[model samples]
Target: MLRVKVAKEIREKEQLGDELKTLRSKVKELEKSLSGLKDEHARLAENEEKFRTLIENSTDLKYRCDLKGRISYLSKAWEDALGYKSTEMIGSKFSDFQSPESIKFDADEFLKELIDKKISSYEAAYISKSGNIIHLRFNVMLYRSHTGSERGIMGTAYDITGLKCIEDQLKQSQKMEAVGRLAGGIAHDFNNLLTAIIGYSEMLMMNNLLPENAFQSADEINKAAHRAAALTQQLLAYSRKQVSRPRAFNLNKLVNNLDMLLRRVIGENIEFFTVLEIDVGLVIADPGQIEHVIMNLAANARDSMPNGGALTFETRNVNLDEEDCEKYPEVTPGPYVRLTVKDTGHGMDKETARHIMDPIFSIMDPIFSIKEGGRRTGLGLATAYGIVKQNNGQLRVTSEVHQGTAIEIYLPRAEEKIEKKETPQRKLETEGGNETVLVVEDESAVRIMVGTLLKGFGYSVIEAKDGNEALEFCRQNKEMMIHLLITDIIMPDVSGFDLVKRVIKTHPGTKVLYISGYSEEEISNKGTLGKKVPFLKKPFTPTVLARKVRGVLDRD
Candidate 1:
């Protein structure tokens, strides 16, 4: 019995040892698992350090601030860009660098957004440590602790000062372009009215209706009307609506002849200098337009100098090679006659110089502090630009504030020697035949004036208010022989061009004369008749209208 009891005790001890060994194995497994976890943690820590280094050294400005708007930290980029040490700005309020005008409202709005939106972004200007204004696009988010409690605000800001400046310049340029187009349109119509008035006045003066005293009054009216007409022509030139009769002409002769007039116009206070190069090559341009361009430029120079200064007009021969064409895409490679107008006056700033050729730029002189009286209508330079462009020329300007301004016009030399066309003698006056003529116009005054003028010329006249009426009249007169058709370019129902086409189709032998206040190019584009058809520009004098009608009717 004693031996059996001792064996039981030994068995119990063996069982106890087995349980202890199993417990040790379990402990060893747990230790291995912990070691693996520690290794992974270390790897993660290294990756986190790399990420922090990248953020701290990134070119983009990275920053963090407390919920109360006090800056906690800023990346090295901010310090490098804005000339600020990160340590010096770390404890400062974010509003400290903001513009005072926008600070309170902007700060309040931003703080509210941070609390409500979790993320907010904006573009704003900030004052740097160097007192320079820097534009920045800021993207910020509210940071939260692991427990979901708000900690601080963090953001990245990108410098955008250069981009902002370019955007502003673009906006100004667009505005100037729009205003130039508007001014050009208005000037075109105004020119037509002035043309009619001046032409009629000249015809009336030839009538010999009054004594010398009355003649002076008529002369004054004529002078004033002519002056106004000249102004309107300038406007038309600016609008690119002016009819340019380009011919090869000697630039030297033109400038020399106009020198005296230019000097007189600029007045004695301002000194005028002409650097006319001897024997400059002939240029293909309208002489009247070139004259107007010179006059307008001289006037502008005069105004620039309230306290008299030197104005120089220089002419030279230049060969525009491939390099010049590359630099100025608008110019072609050829021999060119360069006309430069320089002025020693209060020079224009970059902004003003950029818009000098804009029709409405002069209007803003007061606001921009470029000029005081603002008496000079900015149309002068715009007209010069348009005329130069129409003549296949290039205009370039250089100006420095307080130094001076220089404008250069490069006109291509005439390629071919233009033959002079002799002017035909005026036709002998003749009583009109008994043939009927159709006159179509939209404006009643213009229509009546035309009818009266046609009657004075002794042609039997039939008038229509519009194209539809004109068409009806032609249909009704299918049997009657209509000698000539005088019609306005623009009308309701059917345009003059369409009516002409329809009439020509029905009455193949019918003759048509187109009239318009618009440029001849504009009238021809109506598809009326081919370029072979003649166009009479409005507003025509009674005699001029009579002559045109008679000429068309008598054409072979």
Candidate 2:
């Protein structure tokens, strides 16, 4: 019986040992799992830290909002962009910082984009702390819970202020091109008509057969036609299509010349002051057009202060650099002459000032004056804009409501020395020779008027209605000793340039005289030697025509 009891104790001890080994194995496995859990927790903590660092340092404006569009969290970029601390921005609605136009667009259009798309992007204008405009491009996505239920919205924004400025400038450029096309076409046609009217009126006034009253009527007609011609020139100037007679001239000299006229223009009630800087740099531009620019600005300044205020004109030399060019991409970096005109009168708003210089806006809104009871024409600013641009210059305006207005025009400095005005030339005979001349003009009235003038000047004249007729006459009368070929620069069938080339082959001895109503620039586009050859501009009086004919015939 003792032996059997010992065997049972041994078996029970073995079973107990087996159970202890199993518990030890399970404890070892649990310790390994705990070590793994610690490592995983450390890795996850490191990842979260990296994400936080990235979000904090990002230049993109990152933000989160609740369903009601309330501010939830914002990154550091918001402060740099808007001059506002994150604390001040927290819990505020995004619309609070937006411009009125942006807010209206978000409510009316952006919400629809969000509803139709999981991610929506939009360009918005936000108001800065200083009331300046900041343009931003927002790329937004719907923030959702793990279960796919919508919780809020989150987005990133990029600064697009500079890009927006370039876009606005491009739009302004396109509008100016359109305006140029429209205005240039009208002016070109009107110039042709004016040439005939003025030429005929001058001839009538010179006629010895008319009564004194008839002479008065002819004088009046000539004056009216000249006025009409001036109007056409203004249209061309504003469209930058006018042929500019650019010469290096002193800006200070021009200011002195305009002093008396400006005094009368500003009236007795207004105070006018001249602050001309001696030895101001010379500028290259059409002096007449620059005068127009000054007159337009001065007139507007006078009208702005109808109740009598101070008007000041300041002239100085400025050296513009890359930094200046950066602010104004339309201008080149170089020496410039700055003409500043200031008025103590009501100013314009930002919106109005932005579009005020646009030619299209000026045309559409003729009565759009800047101040109360102002009679200034809408073309005032636009005319200045075109003239400055044509001269490779810039125009800037700075003003605030209730404050005064300041306009600064920058014209490029000329490298050439200022040339003195021409003295009277040696008088040439106003009689034509017995040489045969061909007059080519499309307009019958203008052609007839030119023919009569040449005939009276003692030249044998042959009138051709068009370029084809002119060329055909030259071909048929190949042996005819054509002493002079007077042809229009721009023609429908054949250009005056082509006619000259072909006629020279047959009549090499013929002296060529090109005439046109088109501006020098336009004529150059049509023919190669528009400005290079002996040219006579249209709207010439009988005396001028007579001198031109004799001068061309006598030239070796």
True-vs-predicted CA distance for residue 340, candidate 1, Å: 6.6
Worst 10-residue lDDT window for candidate 2 reads 103-112
In terms of lDDT, model 1 sits at 0.76
Give the Cα-based TM-score of candidate 1 against the true structure. Answer: 0.66
Those runs of model 1 whose alpha carbons end farther than 4 Å from true positions after fitting are 1-105, 125-135, 142-192, 211-214, 237-262, 271-294, 312-342, 348-361, 364-436, 520-530, 540-555
RMSD of each candidate relative to the true structure: 7.7, 4.1
Give the per-residue lDDT of model 2 (tens digit) for 1-556.
8999999999999999998999899899988999899999999999999987899899989999877777899999899999899999989887888998884444435544676794388777999998889999988878789999878879898999988877887788778878877877888788778878888888888789989999999999999988887777777887888878777898988988999999998899999998998878888888999999998888888877878999999999999999778757888898999999999988778887888888766767744544456454646787788888888888898887778789999998888775557567888766767889999988788899989878876789999998888878888987899988888888887888888899899889899888887777777787687344788776666777778878888887
Where in model 2 is the C-alpha error above 4 Å? 1-59, 83-89, 103-119, 146-149, 366-378, 416-429
Q: TM-scores for all candidates?
A: 0.66, 0.85
Tens digits of per-residue lDDT, candidate 1, 1-556, equal 9999999999999999998899899889889989988998998999899988998879999989887778988888988777789888888876677765544435566778778884478776778888767888889898889999988889899998777755765575466456646755665566456545655555456567567777677668768866676666666677666778888888878888998999897789999888888868789888888888888888778877878999998999999998677646557798999999999978888657777765565445453324356554446576788788778898877898878889999998987665344478787464455568888878666676677656756778999999888888778767777788888776767998888888776567878888877776555566644566878776555566677777777889
Count clashes in each candidate, considering only residues at least 3 apart in sequence or on different chains: 0, 0
lDDT of the candidates, in the order given? 0.76, 0.83
lDDT of candidate 2 at residue 328, scale 0 to 100: 77
